[model samples]
Target: MNWKIGLADNWRRLHTKGTVVLSGGLALVTAFGPAIIDAWNSMPPDLKALLPQGIQRYAALGAFLLILVVRYLAVRRKGGGDGAA
Candidate 1:
């Protein structure tokens, strides 16, 4: 059964302590997962040599910036007042 709590009241209950803890936990998981994945992904010998160190670092930085941009767009879309006239 789906028992989603309503946020219409008690915003503080969600925002004060619970949200901070939840966010911190999720941030840890998100960060740690990528590190593990990157370690495995960098293991192959031929593929690593093909990309070269400098290009791979630049590409990784660009991918991170793109992720941030996508997240900003998603937040804006959710909170853009639905483009109401």
Candidate 2:
């Protein structure tokens, strides 16, 4: 029984998730970016001062990563089991 197939399958899954995250992030930025910028601008000065420019981008990335991780765990719990590998 070859183990390389399992490794390849995992790599493909990770690549797919990464692509989904990036594309989803781009779509989110295109859709709600104005609202995000407005919200940031409206934040209290002291609070805003705690985070530097591009914080929104970082927040978006963090949110997406959290989402992906949760979804992956949920699927794993549901017995997806390496997805046919």
Candidate 3:
């Protein structure tokens, strides 16, 4: 099957009530990505120094993924099988 068709089908199948909110969040993130990066880069040296050198991006990504994993587990515990809650 074509990748585009498969993606569309999977999206339709997986979409839930929270899809709109998720889509909106993604749109906002995409729109503000550059500004967000610029802000991070412009933080005061002392503030940036809080994180270890060369690990800022990885730390941020790990924290974000951890939150997502926790949320996923919470939803599963709540029996939110479709993750709409």
C-alpha TM-scores of all predictions: 0.30, 0.42, 0.41
Better of 1 and 3 by lDDT: 3
Q: Which tens-of-lDDT digit does each residue in 1-85 have in candidate 2?
A: 7554345455756745645666676687769878977987898999988887987678778877876675565332355575642
Model 1: residues with Cα > 4 Å off, grouped in runs? 1-30, 33-38, 71-85
Better of 1 and 2 by TM-score: 2
Best by TM-score: 2
Kindly list the per-residue Cα lDDT of model 3 for residues 1-84, writing each as its tens digit. Answer: 655433545576454424444555656876888998899889999998887887857755765675566445533336657665
For candidate 2, the per-residue lDDT at 68 reads 65
lDDT of residue 70 for candidate 2 = 57
Which regions of candidate 2 fall more than 4 Å away from where they truly are? 1-18, 53-83
Candidate 3: clashing pairs of residues: none
lDDT of predicted model 3: 0.64
